[model samples]
Target: MNNYLIKTENISKRYPIRKQNARPDTLVGTVIDFLYKPVRNLKELRNLSSAQNSDYELESYIWALNKINLKIKNNEKIGIIGKNGSGKSTLLKILSRITKPTNGTAIIKGRVASLIEVGTGFHQELSGRENVYLNGSILGMSKSEIDQKYDEIIAFSGVAKFIDTPIKRYSSGMRVRLAFSVAAHLEPEILIIDEVLAVGDASFQKKCLGKMDDVAKSGRTVLFVSHNLESIISLCDRVIWIDDGEIKGDGNPLQIVNQYLETINNISESQIDLTSINRDTNSSFQFSKLIMMNQNNIKSSSFNVGDDLIIKLKYSLKDQNLLKSNLQVKISIHNSTQTEVLNLNNEVSGYIHKLINKEGHVVCKIPHIPLGEGIYSINIEAIINSGAADVINNVGSFEIIPGDYFGTGVPNNTKANFYCISEWE
Candidate 1:
């Protein structure tokens, strides 16, 4: 008998790209187009056969997963990390049987429960209580089995106050809470969760992580996909890094997570051109550039522990009327481990900006930087009238070398992200 609970062999999935002019604008064309789909498919097959195997030339289709092979042993907790649009969710959906791979085989030896998206496998028209039983039955649980676990599910979800209300009335957070409660409590042999847990509050996310830990301890398997690296490191023993629909790295959680973080920091530069990075095109006010400098105002990406650091943010406004609104600029500094060490913002500093131009600069100066020796990334966020206008993560990064913050001439602790200056009594 196979000891692996889940196994996939050369699994791949691709979706046909819809052309802009492929569909007709009129009814008669729609009918003819529908009738001729088979012919079009045959032509596409011929084109695919004659075309190069390179993804760039394959305009007709885009591969979401590319020949992924994995073996998940029983009770193993695995975390999948990747950028957005990567194949993490596709692989989970395949293992959950929610979708089929285009060309490959996946063997699941036991019952599997998945929470891929918010309120997935839930009926909006049905009451929360009813959906619980419904989802349990879908997982092959009998009425008696559902009855045995219903209260515990409701209690853990913290949605008992509206258990009898229709799911449409519940907030996204509530639905995720209930969905996770049902999926985790139904006693499925394997639990597959996507980033949907991000919809829940921090406390609830904590509770869910603890429960997943308990589930894994009970000899059940878990396949989790999340962008939260800290949670992945704490909860999972192994991690898999996927990029461009292929496995790039897989091994120890910290090692794989560090590999993933490296890619994010790889984009960092002394002067980051934020306008070129992927961002919301509709944003009214956006950051255009970020320049890091030392106290002398010379551009730099390296700093000593006690050195003064200056960050200059250049932004552009789409509308001049936005000048009337209160603009706030914030920057978050995080360590190599992705733990945030400091947050600097204009609003908190009681500095109100007087915007007189469509484009301008905002400068944040920090004196006596207490950060220990390590690499740090900076994330920028712009808010207008208390509403987020533009938010960009990992906009740039800097390095901090060893320095004496306590005036003792001793090097700061490298393990910690920040150092404190305290006088000995």
Candidate 2:
């Protein structure tokens, strides 16, 4: 047996395509006029051996993992982090033997168990009780082995009350609890988990991480893939970051991941010009421009919560008695994966009663800012006050990155998005 628990050398997985021309606009022959001129970002594709019709220059093969090389040792707990389509899941699948490599070799040295999707490989048709035995057998456990661990699994899953129920009837969270408990209790030599805790509640997630830690400390190897950087830093000794089908960075979980994050932040900051923000798509009530104003009504984008936020809106009202309008501003603070951490919706004004023909500034003085340090996205909408009625100023999205607040832990979730600055008894 190899001393390293898992090894992969230049491993690549590719999907073969027969070929079809695809673009953003028009049918195969839409008979549309060329003057319409749809806007699109061009994609550069190149070199696929079996691709027919050199007519549309072949693009690069969409290989998910390009020449990945890694060696995992026994009892090592590793985390994988990256953006969407970063091949984090693909790498796990290859190691789980669920998918085969197209270009290189991946070798595993021990009995392996993988939890990718909660309830994956589970038979919906089977009763929860029957599925338990089935999963154990698939894991190469004998009946006696499963029986010995059955109670523990049942207790951990907290589904013992409904053990006889059909698994299909279980809620998404329940399925996750049951599936995680079964896999965790089974005692596999190598545990490959990919964002499984995301389905469970927060407490369950902490518990599951504790379980994984126990397993790793007891000499079982673990490979984890998650978007939660905190978990990656706390639970993993190292990290492997995949990006655009290649290893962008691989090393200490914190340092390398921080570098990747700075790159992401910089890329996002480049797109915040907001110059054409108020342009109308269909030309209803035109929003000329809006600016975040201060206590003195000075326009600005950056501000501390509780500090005055002025909204100077230059708009042309197209209709009269546009009465009962709501000028609502929504702020959503999200993580890199787009999971909403904290959301604040301030209904700054209602019942615009009448429209002043000319443009004017709508002042929104925030008496208390309930947020810590983080980045947030703001959306401004002028609603006609009914369920899904005509939207006036539909312009949404302006960045509201939080400044450092002394003595507060950095806010990064929906709860941490803002702080109340309170004392807990």
Q: Which lDDT tens digits does candidate 1 get at residues 1-425?
A: 87988889999887653322222546896799889979977866665543333343544555779999999899889999986667899999889887778778999998887777655568999999999998877766788998999999999999999999999999988988998888778578998888866778889888988887898888888889987888889889889998868999999999989879877665356787888776532456778999998888888898888888899999888766566566788899877655578998898899988555889999999988888887888888877754557777777889888776677687556766677766678
Clashing pairs in 1: none
Native-to-model Cα distance after best TM-score fit, residue 25 in candidate 2, in Å? 11
Candidate 2 stretches with Cα past 4 Å from truth are: 15-60, 267-334, 337-373, 376-399, 402-425
- Kindly give the number of clashing pairs for every candidate: 0, 13
In candidate 2, position 284 carries an lDDT of 33
Candidate 2 residue lDDT tens string, 122-176: 8988888898888767765789988999999899999898899999999878888
Q: Please report, as a residue range, the 10-residue window in candidate 1 with the lowest summed lDDT.
A: 16-25
Alpha-carbon shift of residue 116 in model 1 (angstroms): 0.7
**Candidate 1 CA-lDDT value:** 0.80
Q: Which residue segments of model 1 deviate by more than 4 Å?
A: 19-58, 169-172, 268-425
